[model samples]
Target chain A: DAGVTQSPTHLIKTRGQHVTLRCSPISGHKSVSWYQQVLGQGPQFIFQYYEKEERGRGNFPDRFSARQFPNYSSELNVNALLLGDSALYLCASSSLFRDRVTGNEQFFGPGTRLTVL
Target chain B: ELKVEQNPLFLSMQEGKNYTIYCNYSTTSDRLYWYRQDPGKSLESLFVLLSNGAVKQEGRLMASLDTKARLSTLHITAAVHDLSATYFCAVDTPLVFGKGTRLSVIA
Candidate 1:
């Protein structure tokens, strides 16, 4: 079985511009989460979607938004980007919503490297 | 405001040496996970520790979690060059991750 998939492996955008990153979860996976990883730092959760509904949101600002499609694919949209926005956008998928045992071990994609110039 | 902290942000060791990476979180969480990432690559799931004193092992790597102390440890035994990678520990609440420990095993 294939793992999580992301599109636009790399992108370069100027400040104040908008960017959209895509992700396709593994087959039969229902939960998708987005994270931003700055250089030399760990990933920070941005948003999570389950069954086309917003399940959880992180400390990101209003400029960031996301939606999950019926097929469980997700898109993270960032508007009015800043130089600090230059980082890797990662997408992770899990089979269960609330894991009673292990809390759904997330499988991550290769991630989209976004550079705000 | 969950925060995950990892000790020894960078580790360089010779092959066949044993080492342990520690992960401590600020908040309480029943679920903890360990992941590995290569340069320019995504994270790969390694282990998930659910309860206190939970332990899991694979190959040369083993992970243990102590929920009461809010700590997790990843132990590498007889490390090999192929085991070189950045290891991250994550918690369930808010999905917070540690800064990660970059392991470089020299042959």
Candidate 2:
């Protein structure tokens, strides 16, 4: 089976511009999450969607937003980008929102490398 | 606030050596996860520990979790160059992540 896939493996944009990164979850998966990984750091969660509904959100600014389509694919949009936003944006998907007792494993895509100039 | 921390932000060892990477989290959490990422690469899931005293292993890597102590460890046995990468540990609540440990194995 194919793993979760992300589109536009690389992107470059200028400050104040808007960028859209896309992700397709693994077959049979329904939940999608987005994360940002800056240089020399771990990935920080940004948003999560399950059944096309927002389930969780991280401490990102309003300029960052995301939505999941009915087909379980997701799009992460960032507006008015800054140089600090240049990093690898990762997308992960699982069967559902995990519970403490029954945890779910998040499968990540290769990620989109976005460079804000 | 939930925070995950990993010890020895960087590790350098020769092939055939053994080492352990520690992960400590603040507060109580239900699950702990270990992931590996290469330079400019995405994360690859390694292990998930769901409960106290949970232990899991794959090939030359082993991971153990202690909910009471709020700690987890990833031990590499007979490390090889293929194991070189950054390792991160995450907690379940909001999936808090550590800064990551960069491991370099030299032959």
- In model 2, how many backbone clashes occur? 0
| lDDT tens digits by residue: candidate 2, B23-107 | 9999998799999998889999999899899999999999999999999999999999999999999998457899999999999
Could you tell me the TM-score of chain B in model 1?
0.97
Regions of model 1 farther than 4 Å from truth: none
Model 1, B1-107: lDDT tens digits are 78899998999999999999999999888999898999989999999889899999999999999999999999999999999999999998457899999999998
Cand. 2 TM to true fold: 0.97
Q: Against the true two-chain complex, what DockQ does each candidate achieve?
A: 0.81, 0.82
lDDT of 2 by residue, A1-117 (tens): 999999999999999999999999999899999999999999999999999999999999999999999999999999999999999999999887865555888989999999999
- The models' CA-based lDDT, in order, is 0.93, 0.93
Instruction: Indicate the worst ten consecutive residues by lDDT in candidate 2 chain A.
Output: A95-104
Docking quality tier of model 1: high
